[model samples]
Target: MKNSFIFLFLLYSTILFSQKTTDYLLDKKEISQRELNSLSNFPIYKAYEFSDKGGVYNLVLGENQQKITKKDTLNTKIKAICAMNDHGGFLEKWSINDLLEAYEPKETNIWFWTKYCTLKDLDGDGYIEPIIVYGSKTEYGEVRRVKIITVYKNKKYVIRAVECDLDYCRSFKKDAAWNTLPQKVKTYVDQLVIKLRKEQNLLLKDG
Candidate 1:
């Protein structure tokens, strides 16, 4: 009977330890020369600093540009986002590559919507969730594609949308796993999408 009680106590303690929460804070930081050198492989354009129970973390966003030599001069753009620990070891990375094509009237443009990128513990989880938003546009900017990528617990949730005008999105897609997220996290992301659509003037009929 005493052993059974001890077993129960230990199990309870283990559950509490596994669910322990850490406070995380994120702030934009100037990239030092040393940090730049460390990330020399990436064309880093922006960076942020954050810390939790584990240690400090650096998050960076950049693009890899390569010239496309065809009939017309173009470029292949690869947007890269990464997070590294204090030891300079990469923790997570996300990337998307797209080819710049001449669309007769206008060329395709792809970029990160840095203003909406954020790091937060929306679900009150010990881990910080990194939310990244980016977009691509062609057809003389008449058609736009927006994407939001959020990483929680090393798992990614994605939301993709095609913007029509300035009122609603023409179409939107959410990963199946998105529906399984905490309600608060889902709400926060939904608000972010609304703000992005309104601020960017990318509204569709039934967005």
Candidate 2:
């Protein structure tokens, strides 16, 4: 018990000091030229896809999308996620330099994904749970994190994050290994949080 308590204390202290990532803005002129280039053409990144799904609970779309009256905006966000299939996901964008730029380049290059996932009711009480699947490029590998951002009855949350990367590979390995206890076979999963990837005309399907 004492050992567990000490371990928890250490873990809490680490989280207490952790900081959200930041996304720096390049000069519009500098960015314009690079934006024109293809995925293979650009080296330094624009802060979105290049990041390995590291941010937690960021409201880049703002919480307004989840508002009942704001259904239009919510649809827009979903449409955008569905559109990632065209010409690769290199065009995924989140330029927050105008309002806030607290997003760090390395930490998450994203805002609003969670350090640890939590549950929420983005979908109404009775309905197929709605979700948002974000696609992007990461240093280690592809990163997809699902989220349900909705505010119901004054309760709002950022929930459901399933990431695909080397860092979280252990959690995935453990789960798969447990199921195949008798015969050990390496379970390789590089895409864990991806609801859809590289599927042409993906928008035609439900998110």
Candidate 3:
């Protein structure tokens, strides 16, 4: 029994360490640059058993040439895979552009922006930085660069930005955020009128 338990533990640990994260949008399955935006897009696998509530379904063929389908009607019964998951209703029809354009500060709060903006503590500064993902295109959807404004409470200096995609990720770079603009990212920020500055930056208060 002791030997059996040790073998099982080793097997489990090996399997867990062997697996790596993936992004369905990319064909290669592996990339050097790790982006926080990939968190929202998780992996989905198709296996046995039929679920009526699920959005994705297909005809299954087994031994003896049997045909199995979840629903009889395709149009009315079948739902988009995205519609059933992550997407809060009608998200199946919307695109990345729609999400960026729809990020209203008052209507959708910080919790809601995780679908587009990801919070990460890559700098080890204790404070999590908001990494905003702009679009959802295969070739060029993710924003390679962004801005880091120093925020203050009462004229006290805050921590500096240590991590960045390039010079843009550094602090006090002029037109840094605008340099690697996503399609609607400029308009989206402009619409909100966020006051980001070099010395002190203010958060966009919920309207």
Candidate 4:
């Protein structure tokens, strides 16, 4: 009887773990106005929604313009990626903002690389890590800068890179905490860096 009980307990544990693994897997979902209202406390002048997992994540992109002068306006962009439990209790919120120089003849553009932004339970912690990427570049795409931001638990890791064909300059910076992330997470970020480089026609490999 004791042996049977032990076997059944182990089997139940295994099944529970499997179910959790499946539940934490991320999937894309359509955005809804109700979800946007929940984030009204944020500075959401103009917003784009990327909600997912039955409202478990209220990821959104908020944008606004600040008028500096009659001929010049500064553009501000924000990303608010929030994680919540099944009961709608907030777990963590990752917010980032970027400001573009006042408008000029140079023509600057700033935007989130929405296709690269992803949510995953890379460590199987039953909570998803959000990876967000954005960039700003000149009108002709001569000089470009990209930023990759990812949050694990309440900690954030970032990578900043600049690519310029006009001056043949390429460089990148990693946050000091980057090395603290799990090997699997590091590998995932590296792969994304490679993809972003390729898309921009960068010749130098990521260091």
Candidate of highest TM-score: 4
Candidate 4 has which clashing residue pairs, if any?
none
Best by lDDT: 1
lDDT of 2 at 25: 33
Model 3 spans > 4 angstroms off: 26-207
For each candidate in turn, the TM-score is 0.66, 0.22, 0.21, 0.69
Whole-model alpha-carbon lDDT for candidate 2 = 0.28
The Cα error of candidate 4 at residue 40, in Å, is 5.2
Q: 1-207, model 3: which lDDT tens digit per residue?
A: 999999999999876554432222322222212221232232211111111212221111111112235732111111112121233222231111111112112111111112333222323333322233211111122221222221111011112122223443334222433434433433444442343322123322211
Please give the CA lDDT of all the candidate structures: 0.63, 0.28, 0.25, 0.61
**Ranking of models by lDDT:** 1, 4, 2, 3
True-vs-predicted CA distance for residue 137, candidate 1, Å: 2.0
**Runs in model 1 lying further than 4 Å from the true structure:** 1-42, 65-76, 86-107, 165-169, 204-207
Give the worst 10-residue stretch by lDDT in candidate 4: 21-30
Task: Judge candidate 4 against the unseen true structure and give its global Cα lDDT, from 0 to 1.
Answer: 0.61
Two-way TM-score contest, 1 vs 4, winner: 4
In the range 1-207, model 2's lDDT, one tens digit per residue, is 999999999998776544323333344454444442233222222212111123222122212132234322211122211002234334333221111122222222222323212222222232111123232223333343333332222222223333433443212212322332112111111122232334311221122
Which lDDT tens digits does candidate 4 get at residues 1-207? 999999999999887665432223222233343355355343443333233323445555654543345854334454454544345544545567676644322537566667777777776655566787877656564536688888877578999776654343566889988999988889999988888768866533343
Residues 1-207, candidate 1: write the lDDT tens digits.
Answer: 999999999999877655543323233344663254365354665666665444456666665534334532222464544555535555554444444445333546666677888777677655677788877666465546677888776677988776654443367888988988889888999899778758767662245
